[model samples]
Each structure stands twice: as structure tokens, then as C-alpha cells.
Target: MSGRDLLQTQLERGIAALGTSLPGGAVARLLDYQELLHRWNSAYNLTAVRDPAEMVTRHLLDSLAIIPFVEGATLADLGTGPGLPGIPLSIAAPEREVTMVDSNGKKVRFLREAIRSLKLTHAHAVQSRVEGVEGSFDCITARAFASLADMLGWGGHLLARNGVWLAMKGRHPAEELDGVPPGFRVEGIHLLNVPGLDAERHLVVIRREG
Candidate 1:
């Protein structure tokens, strides 16, 4: 089979593994986004993961694993290189407004094109540092962008009261939990089961303490 076909198959398998009940066309759009990412990575170097099949497991599935933890109507993906979790989450939850923020020019351009090409009207790309972003979001996602403390330090103000901050990490970050900001508290740390991904993946759920 051709490479794209193989990728489609892999993505379908991964989605089934996640056991997510998504709207129709969600899987197709994710495959399309990955294709666009692979094409652009040839020159722009958007992500380090090069193999298409691996991208299915590492990027797409890894991103979708956090879908269950998301809450509320708006989400902001900080340091969203190549729009990893942001684009996928936006596709899955089209009703929610997803804003992908990044400081890199090329990555932002790629994200815009993907959003337009994939017809993701609810998702928008912004070019700025996390600290410079404006407005509050009900859910904010940071995918290994920085330490839990530093990420909350830079973009913590953007989270709406009672909102949840979903931080993706490679391992259980026991040490990183030591310095969570004053307003936010560690609500939960759930382990992720990403099909075909061997490395440890955990989602750190932080919410503003009442």
C-alpha cells in the first residue's frame, strides 16, 4: 500500500485504541493534518519526529490521549509547535474555540495553513510568546513546553478562574509539582496509554483552587 494509505490505517488503529467516541471525519482530518505536517517538516523542521507511522503513535495518538481530561468551552495550546495537540483537539472538539500559540514564524504559518486546509474554523493560530497572549480560556494545554512551574508562570494568568490546565509530560513529574503557583493546585496526575508508544506519558491536571 502507498504511504498515505498506510498512515490512514495506522491513525485509524490508534484512534480505536484510544476508545474515543469522536464525531465523524475526526480521524480523516487528523490524517490530513499529519500529512501536512510531514510535507512541511521537510523544509521548516517543524517537529523532530520524521517517520509517518511513528508520528501516528507519538504525535496524533499522544495528543488524543488527553481528550478525556479536557474541560469547558475554550482551550489554548501554548508553545504549539506544528500544532500537535491543539490541532487534533480542535478537530475532535470543534465546538470549543482552540487557539494555537507559538513564537516561531514558520510553525505559525504552517498551523494557519493546516487550519485553513483542514477547514478547522474553530481553531486559530497566533504568533506570540505565551506570556504575551491575551484573554482567558477554560482549558489550557502545554505539551512538554516547559517545567510545570515555568509554564504556569508564563501563561498561568491566561487561565480563567475554575479552568483546568492540562500539562503533558514524559514522566510522572513528582519534583515539578513542588513549586506549583499559588492559585493553581494539582488536581490529578493520570497516566496515559498511547498505543504503540513505549515511553511513559502522563497528564498533569491543574485547576485554580477555590
Candidate 2:
């Protein structure tokens, strides 16, 4: 099989493994985004992961794993270096308004191009630090961006009153639990089962304390 076919098969299997059904044409769009990412990474060094199959696992599947936890109509992916979860999630669920925020100009440029080329009407890219980003969102996602404390300290204000904060961590961040800042509490830490990914993946869910 050709490389693109292999990648498509891997992605389809991974989605099936996750037991999540994406809308028609979503998978194709996701692959298109991945291809764009691969092309840009060569010159811009956007991400550390380079292998196509690994990208399907670590980037695409890893991002889709959190689809079950994502809620609300608006989502802000802070520190979205290359729109990992945001872009994928936007493709899967075209109804949500996704804002991919990042400080890197090159990454943001790529994001814009992907949005236009993929016809992602609900997704947009913003070049700014997480703290500098304005407006509240129904859901906020931070993946490998910063420590729990620092991430919340800088961008906590962006979460709406009833919004949830989904912090994607590598492992169970037991030590950082205490440093989650006041007013917010850890609701749950879900173990993400990313297909073809053996490493530890945890999703720390936080919300305003009632």
C-alpha cells in the first residue's frame, strides 16, 4: 500500500480502537491536516514527532482520545503549537467553534493555511501568549503546554463560569495537584487509552469549586 493509504488505515484503525465515530469526510480532513503538518515541520521544526505512523498515534489519535471529555460549543486550545487536538477535534466535530492559540508566528501561519485549505469554518488561529488571549470559552484545553499551576495562573480567566479545563498530562501529576491554584479543583484524572501509544497519558479535568 502507498504511504497515504497506510496512514489512512492506521488512522481508521486508531479511531475504531477509540470506539469513537467521526463524521463523514472527517478522517480525510484530519489526514490532510497531518500532511500539511509534515510538510511544514521540515522547514519550521513545528513538532518533535516526525514519523507518519507515529504522528497518527501520538498526534492524531492522542488528540482524539479526549473527544469524549470535550463539552460545550466553544473551545480554546491554548499553547496550541501546531493545533494538535484543536484541529483534529474541529474536524471530528465541525459544530464547535475552536480557537487555536499559540505564541509562535510560524505555527499560527500554518494553522491559518490548514483552516482555509481544509475548509474548517469553525476553527481559527490566534498568535498570542495564553495569558494575553482574551474572551472566555466553554471549554479550554492545554496539552504539554506548561505545569498545571503556571497554565491556570496565566489563562484561568479564559474559562467560562461553568466551563471545564482539560489539561493533558503525560502521567498522573500527583505532585501538581496541590498547586492547581485556588477556586479551581481537580474533578477527575482520566487515563487516556491512545491506540498504538504505549506511553502514559492522563487527562486532568478541573472546574470551578462550587
Candidate 3:
């Protein structure tokens, strides 16, 4: 089956598992993103998940799982390689401004293309390290970016006073929280049941106490 066909099937499976209605526009945007990723992956080597079916589970559904927690907020996706949670989040919540940051120039290029293709007015891709980018955000998200402690060290400064950091992890990160930085405090740890993927998922929300 073609990539688009596979994506459609996977999206159906995801919709069933999520048990929530996906925005009509989201389906088209996700298909477009998969097509672009497939085209770019040949040259840019953006993501390891080349199969469209896997992209739906690993990228689309996995990102969508956090939508309920991401209401209307200015979000920054640190280390957004090929715009995993960032691009998908932008598609799901068009009103929310999303900035996708990545250190890899090629991946940023692909992200920008996807943004343009999707006509995402509220989304932009930045080619820079997390620390180099300025401006505080209401919600900051990262997927497979770094360890909890490392993310806190670099991305902690980019969050607004009452902002929240939603870090996506594969497993419970209780042990990694032992040496958290001084300014931030863990508000909650949510176990995310992502659709179409069997991997363990956790959303760690942190906020600055002072």
C-alpha cells in the first residue's frame, strides 16, 4: 500500500483508540506531513521512523495524546526534529502559536516546508539550540529531546513564570527527578495512554515555584 493509504488506515485505528473526534483539518494536515516526511527523509534523514504507519503511531497519535493538556497557549517544542509534537500540535490547535526549534539545519528546513505546506499561520520553525532561542512560552513541550534533568537545565529558563513544561517520556521518570534544579517544581506526572502505540508514555509537568 502507498504511504497515504497506510496513513489513512493508521489514522482510523488511532481515531478508534483515542475515542475522540479528530478535527477534520487534522486528518488532511497529518497526511500532508507524512507525505512531506517521506519525501524529505530520503535526503535529509529527518526521522528514523520511515514507515507511514509507524509515523501515525509514534508521531501523530503520540503527539495528539497531549492535546487535552495543551489548551490555548504559546508553546515551544524544544529539539523538534521533523516537528514530532510541535507540527502535530499546530495542526490540532491552529489558534495556538507554536515555535519548533531544532539544532539540525536540514530538519528545520523540512519542518519549515511542512509549515508552509500546511498553511500553518501560527507555526514557525527555528534552527537553533534550545538555549540560543529567547522569549518565554506558556507551554513548552519536548519529545525524545533529553533527560529530564538536562531539559530542566536548558529549557527551564524559556518558560513563563506560571508556565508549564510538558516533557514526554517513554517511562516513569521518578528516579530522574531526584536532582531537579532549584527553581522548578514538579506539578504532576500524568501517564499518557497514547493510541496505536504500545510504548509506555508519561507527561511530566513542571513549573517554577518562585
lDDT of each: 0.93, 0.93, 0.85
- Model 3: ten consecutive residues of lowest lDDT: 15-24
Candidate 3 residue spans exceeding 4 A from truth:
1-6
For candidate 1, which ten residues in a row score worst on lDDT? 13-22
- Residues 1-210, candidate 2: write the lDDT tens digits: 999999999999999999999999999999999999999999999999999899999999999999999999999999888997899999989989999999999999999999999999999999998878999899999996789999999999999987899999998899899998888989999999999998999999999654
Which parts of model 2 are misplaced by more than 4 Å? none
lDDT of 3 by residue, 3-96 (tens): 5776788787786777756677788888888888888998888888988778888888888888777744799999989998999888888888
Instruction: Rank the candidate models, highest TM-score first.
Output: 2, 1, 3
Window of ten residues with lowest summed lDDT in model 2 = 201-210
Reference-based TM-score of each model: 0.97, 0.98, 0.93
RMSD of 3: 1.7
Candidate 1 structure quality by residue, lDDT tens digits, 26-120: 88889899889999999999999999899999999999999999989999999999997999999998989999999999999999999999999
